[model samples]
Structure formats: structure tokens, C-alpha cells
Target: MSLYTTTLLILDPDPYNSIDRLYRRVIQQAMHVTLPTGCLDIFVARPPTRFRETHFVVAQLYKISAELKQLENKEDIDVRVLLEGVGGFDIGDARNRSWEVVAVGKSDSKLLPVFIAEQHSSWFSPALQIIILPMERSIETSSRLPSLPSDEDGSHPPTEEGPHLGEAGLVIDSTDEEGGDLDDEGEEAQYPIVALGGTFDHLHDGHKILLTMAGFLTGESLIIGVTGEALLQNKKYKEYLEPFPQRCAAVLNFLAYIYPALHATTDEINDVYGQSVTIEAIDALVISGETRQGAKLVNQERTRRGFHALKVWEIGVVNGDANDQWAGKLSSTDLRKREFEKGELAKGQGTQQKLE
Candidate 1:
């Protein structure tokens, strides 16, 4: 099977809310639609800052990967997430970056880079482009490429020229025509105040996804419960754990970046329930699949305390690749273990050099 590395360019005005649907489309394109043969590398490029955080975007990619494993029954496609920096939104800049990412060494190859975008534009040189329309359109896959004008007799004529290769290689273009259309969709089902509790240690991509989802579900404010040090005493690699203040700062930094308008507050919690069980203002609770039972327990406590049971929203666990030395769901424990092993290896090398 031939492997094709394709970079998908998306103009996501608001990823925190649209990521779920965007990811679904990516999976559909790779599995049920085009490029089902070889290994497909889907690098999703989105504009940065106002509504999207790089970390959050990567987390969504991980979620997509996990879903693909279940839906496709294998890891044939590798999904990577890339962020278009502050000033890289221009069509030319995006084309340059996409080519740089996939064009590692095929300088003399005849393969023209495939460019997929929502609308057809002359800005892209037709002689140097292979444009694929968005998946939602009903056009045939072959019809997506720009076709030469037919003869007046309505018969298709063969042209001397083939598809022109773009200067930067393959380019895929896509637009977010649905942007802001679904913004209020989450509003109708909004929770005025949402609460989520976690150790948030090291704040990996998984944590960012959880935080981004929580922020998107919220309408007015969000309360993050950072686990206190006392609760992490029994955790593995406790010595390497980040301090509570640092963890809180990292969480807030991400929340602020993706949700600048959201009102956020962080507090220390020694217990699993935190203020969720007692806080009447909190309308919902966000948790990961692993901690879902904990959310139920918090609800139980709330019921006992005469408070309304908080709505529970669970995000799936971001699984790690089996190819990884430490294969399992992403967690702080796995990260710390990797770091510890690297340190030990360094020390062993130092000792061996000294003895020699």
C-alpha cells in the first residue's frame, strides 16, 4: 500500500466549540471516503490565538486518534495537529508551511501536491494546484480537481499539459462556512457555571482538551478545582510533581488563551468533591472517562446535601500509541516515568564515561 501524507488546512474561527465536528469530518474523510489505502497522515492546520489554543487543538487530535482506533479497527492513519502562528493566515504562508511539513525529500518527484479547500480561488495558480472540494459537497472525488474547458461540441478533449505541481508541493484548502453559526447552539444548552476538578499536573494535551470542553460548555463562568498537595502524596513520582500553584497557573493560562471572555476561578481541593457538591451556582461538572464515577459520587453528595444534582459531561481518555515505550492512556504518571528514565540513562552514561 502506498502511504500518502496529506496536510488538511482548516480556517477554524472557533476550535474550542467546532473541534468535535471538525474531527468527525477528518475521520470520515480518511476512513469512509478518500485515501483509504496507505498510511494517511492528517495534519490539521488552524489559525492561532483568538479562539484556538495549540494545546487544545492537539488534544482534539488525540481524541480523534482514539475514535479512529475504535471506528477503523486499526491505527492506519496518523493524525498530527499544527497551529498557524499569529501572522501565518495568508494563503501563501499556509501553502509554504504545508509544503515544508510534507516535502521532506521528494524534490525531483513528479507527484503534484494535492490542495483541498472549500472554495475555488484564482489566488491559487491552477497550473500548479490540485484542489479537492470540502467533503460535505456531493461532487465526485475526481471532479474536485480543476478541469480543462471542454470543446464546443460538448466532447472532452485531451490537453497536452498535466496537472501543474505547486511551487510548495501539495496543498489542501478548507473553509469554515459554518463558523459562528453553531456558536449559539451551545448557548441554548449552556450551563451558567461549570465546575471541573483534577490534579492537572504537568497539564498535557489531554488536560487541555478537558479544559477547553469545559470552557465551551460554560456560558458565564468556570471554576477549576486543583488538587491539593496533600492528595498527591501517594501518587507515583511524587517528587517530580509540579507544585499546586504551578499547576493552577498552567490551567488558567490555557483557559485564558482559548476563552478570553470567560470568567474563571481556581481553588485548591483536598477531596474529590471539592466545592462541586456544595456549590449551588455550579450547574454542571466536567470530567474524564476515568473520573466519571467520581462525578457520580459528587452528584450523590449533592443530592444528600439538598442541592440539585449537577449535570455530568464526560470526555473520553486520550489513549497513547502502542508504539510508545509506555503504551496506555495519557497521564501524568506516564510522562513522569519517561522523564525519570531519561534522567537515569543520562546518569548511567556519565558514570560509564568516568570509569573509562
Candidate 2:
């Protein structure tokens, strides 16, 4: 199937109750029309309350993505949630360990064939390949691009033109005047330098949320310690573990897109402490909920070395439905295993066909 490598989805919560239904319908429709395999950038606009309630946004998106796996012919879509634009809020003082709201915006060129709910259509222009949600059992748009068939029937035509920005819309660029100055009163002052460590193997949404939270906290620099080869020898599906360089590059690239305003540094760490124990300048450490105990060990080592204890912040794990084979947490190891299973299934199907 022909797919759009990257697509933008603009969302605005009209009554809050429809958010979940709206998201599911949009995904169901897009699968038929655009086949977004590379990435799905969800841009939420208006209703400043949604910005303040970020935990809801993150949880809802993750829920929808998890449900996508149950759908037939669902592709692996990298779901990214953005909360920056007209009537949107900035990444405020979201340092608490609780699932607080943290706004996000990206700097990317026009994403073609944008999918938006009919109620939130006022946020963008109609000249682009715009697909409205709650679709009339058909793919409807005002763009000059040819009309495509619905998810259930008809031909899937390719869209040639790119996305268009609304006259009053914001692109959330760091260099551009409109998107500039996102940080108010040195938002980084709370934490001059933020630090975090992870294996970052497959670079999934869980990793993105962790990194973004750290990036949002950083005022000066974001220090990421990518696990070295020595530490990853026993990882599950070790063969599928991405090379350290590739993993590091993916982390850096994602940071540039989501929070380009700050300078980020990545280091290869052979041990658990990494630079967090040695770097005296680091103001804070971002960790997942499961590693809260490790934060104490890090601080104890720092205090032993005559260094100040770093203020540690935590982010909750992105969870999938509990099942016998898969735990609740969205893990890279589980992702790798799923990929391996898919490969094995395809191999079995191919062999069966050959025998026939």
C-alpha cells in the first residue's frame, strides 16, 4: 500500500468527551486514505485547559496507539503529541513527579495530507490535502488533490501537494518569529542543566516522553547517557537492538524536532551512573517511575563524592493493556520481540504458500 511517510493531525477538544472517539475515527479513516506509516504528528490546539491537563493528552494518545495494534493491517505509526499553536500553552513549571502537563511543539516543514476533525477545521487552510474527521463514509477534502476512496472501498490515490498553514496558525519554529520565545522568563531557570540515562534501543514513544520531559526541564543543556555496548550484552532480542550510534542519532534527531531551542549532548556510558554522578553542573535528573530507587543511589554516590544532591524528577511509564504475553509498560524489549514474532509469522506464511 502507498503511504504518506509523515502526516499531521490537528486536534481541538470541543467538549472533552469526544476526544477519544474522535481520535479513533481519525486513525481508522487515515489508514484507508493516507496509510501513514512513518509518523503521526498530533497537534492539539485551542482549549487552553487541554494544555494544562497534559497527562490526559499523553494517556489518551497512548491508549489510541495501543488500540491500533488490534486493528487489521495497522502499520507501525510513531505517534507524537504536540501542544503548541494559537491558544496553546507553553511547557510550564512541570517539574513534579506527578503526571503533570508539559506542552510540546516541533519544527518541521509542511506535513502533507493533514487529518483534522471537522470541528477543529478552523485552525488550518483548506488548500492543502486536508481530510476531515467523522467522514461521511468517504474521504472529503477541499484541496485540489483528487478525491480518494474511503477506508472500506475505492482507489487510494496519491496526494502530490503539501500541507498548508492557516492565516493565523503557528508553525512553532525556533528560528521563526512566530514560534520564537516559547520560553518565558527563562523557563530553564528551574533547572539550568538536566540529565537522564537510558538504553534508548528502539526509540519508542515511551523514550520520547522521557526525553521530552527532560528537554522541557532543561534551561541550558540536556545531557543524555546512551547505554554503551558493554551494558546491552544481555538485552532480550539482542540481535534487534539498534547499534549505539544509530540509537544516539535517533535520540538527538528527535530532540532537534521537538525542542530545538536548547543544546543537547549525548555520551556513551559503560556504567549505570554515567555522567550524572560526575557532572557537578547538572541541576536535575529525569527518570522513569520504575527507576525511582536508582535515583537515590545516584544521589548517594554524588553526596559521597562531596557533590550536592541533584533534584530528581520522574515520568510515569507509558502502558499498554495488561496481557499474559505483554506487561503494562511500553518497553523496547517487548517491541523487539513483537517485531521478531511478526517476522516468524511472515516466514511461516511464505513457506505455506510455497508448499501449495
Candidate 3:
């Protein structure tokens, strides 16, 4: 089967209904058989006027994460989710203390693939060699493809009955013009400098989301604090931790790939505060919802230092397969443990083969 470096899928709002069957076919035909290098970017098309609930968007993201973890082949394909017609999803509560909206362009059918290919051409092939569409829309959509030659054409059949968005815990913010809630003046807030901290080991989709949000909010620079060995000593599978330099490089390389325009810098963080308290220029801090308390502590330190408190923004956790041992929030420690186990299993199999 021919392999594609980059592929695009235009999906509906409720993609969880068909995610399993859809990805199964995608992996079999379009993906690299041995080692996958590029990403499959899925743009979920929402009605231009309808408000996409933040919880529903997060649920779809976790559903994709869980499905990828369940695949036996485990080709390690990187999948990214983007919503159509919405710049970003604002997930904060009434006080807006939770998180800022991570901005993305409104999807244009004619320009989606072209824009992606142009931006990623430096790292991966520019052509979107495979285009996957819903079965109902495949025949009509095929006629609209750009001049690029496609290796394969694929479609997914319609899904069976599924729960309604509202029934599945969706909250509609009808007052806001877009996906996010507005300020008292009815305008979205923008920060010039944003900072976030993480281990960024084995950088995966979860890390990618956090980085993307921070970069999106940043108008001047995105400051990242990668945990140093001193801070990672107690982590599970610490034996497999990537060197500090490698971890920092991986985070910067990914930022360049996704947000080429973003001015980003990384620091080795031995302490939890990192540069968030030290740097007086930072306007906001982006963190995972699970790390809200950490953000609060950073603010306390900033206050103690006589600097103003930075705005706090939280991104929801991306979860892995619930049935497997790696289930729960997508974690780097779990990934390291998985690699160790795989190596051990290989060693045992090799010994048995030699004896036989």
C-alpha cells in the first residue's frame, strides 16, 4: 500500500461516533506501515452559526486520544483536531480564571489542505496525498479537490444513532459571538507574552495542545519551562528520561513546526516557579486543568516578589484508552514505562528463540 506523509479529514461535530471505524481504515491504507512521521489533521466542521460547547470539543479530543491508544498496530500516527468556523474554544468559568481560547483559523474547504501543506512543507511532504471524507459527502467533495495528485480516496459510512450534544453535557454560550465568552466590553482578551511549564518528554498530542494554546495567546513571546533532572528524580521510569537538552530541543522543534511565527524560548526548570515569577514581562500562564493549583502558586510567588499576578489559562486533559494500563491523563511517565516493558518483552522473546 502507498503511504502518505500528510493527510486531511473533514469531520462532523460528533466524531466519536465513527472514530474507531474511520481510523481503522485510515491506518490500514494511508499511514506508514512501520514508522509514522507526519500527522493526520482532522477539521471538525461545525455549523457556522451554532456554538460548539467546550465540554463537547474536549470530549471529542479525548475520544480520539483513547481510540489511538487502543489500536493494536500502534503505528504512532500523530492526530490533531481543529474545529471549523471557530477561532478557538474559550473554556473558562464566569470569572474567566480558567483558560484562554487557543486560536485557529476558520477552515476554508478550498484552502485547508493548501495552507497546511505550505506550513509543513519544510518538515514533511507538502502534498496532502490522501483525503478522507464522510461517505455521504465523498462523491460531492471529490470534485472540489485542488490540482494535487492523490494516492488514494477513502470515505467512512454514516454513523449509527448517537447521543445529542446537549444530552452529552454540552453547555451553549449563546451570548458570545464565537466559541469563547466575551469580556464586559464584548471583546476577546489578548496577551502579549505567555508562559507555560512542563516536562515535555516524548512530546505527544497532550503537550502539543498546551504549547499551542500558549503560543496562540502570545503576541510577543512564548516562554516555556522544561523540567530539569532535579525536578524529575521522583518521576516513574526516570531511567528513560530524555536528556534535558533533548527535551528542550523537542519542545522548540515542535513549536517551530506548528507555530512558525511564534517567538518561543525554553528554560531548564529546577524549581516549580521557573521564570513565571522571575520574568516581569509575562502576561499570562497556560496550564493543564489538573495543574491549576500550580498556576496559583506561581501567582503567589509573583505577588511575594512584588510583581503583578499573571493571568491563568487552563487546557483540559487529553486522556488515553480507559481499558489499558496507560489509561488516564496522557502522561510522559506512562510512555516511558511502556517503552521499558516493550524492551523487556523483546528481550524475553529473543532468549526463548535462541534456546529453541
Candidates' lDDT values, in order?
Answer: 0.54, 0.57, 0.54
Each candidate: RMSD: 15.6, 15.4, 12.1
The residue pairs found clashing in candidate 1 are 113-170, 114-170, 114-171, 115-171, 115-172, 116-172, 116-173, 117-173, 117-174
Tens-digit lDDT string for candidate 3 (123-149): 433323324322322212222211212
Write one digit per residue (lDDT tens) for candidate 1, span 86-161.
2122333333332212221122112223232422233543322232324321212232122224367533343323
TM-score of 2: 0.64
List residue ranges in candidate 1 displaced over 4 A.
Answer: 1-9, 12-60, 63-188, 320-327
Give me the displacement of residue 45 in model 2, in angstroms. 2.7
TM-score of candidate 3 versus the correct structure, residues matched by position? 0.64
Instruction: Specify the highest-lDDT model's number.
Output: 2
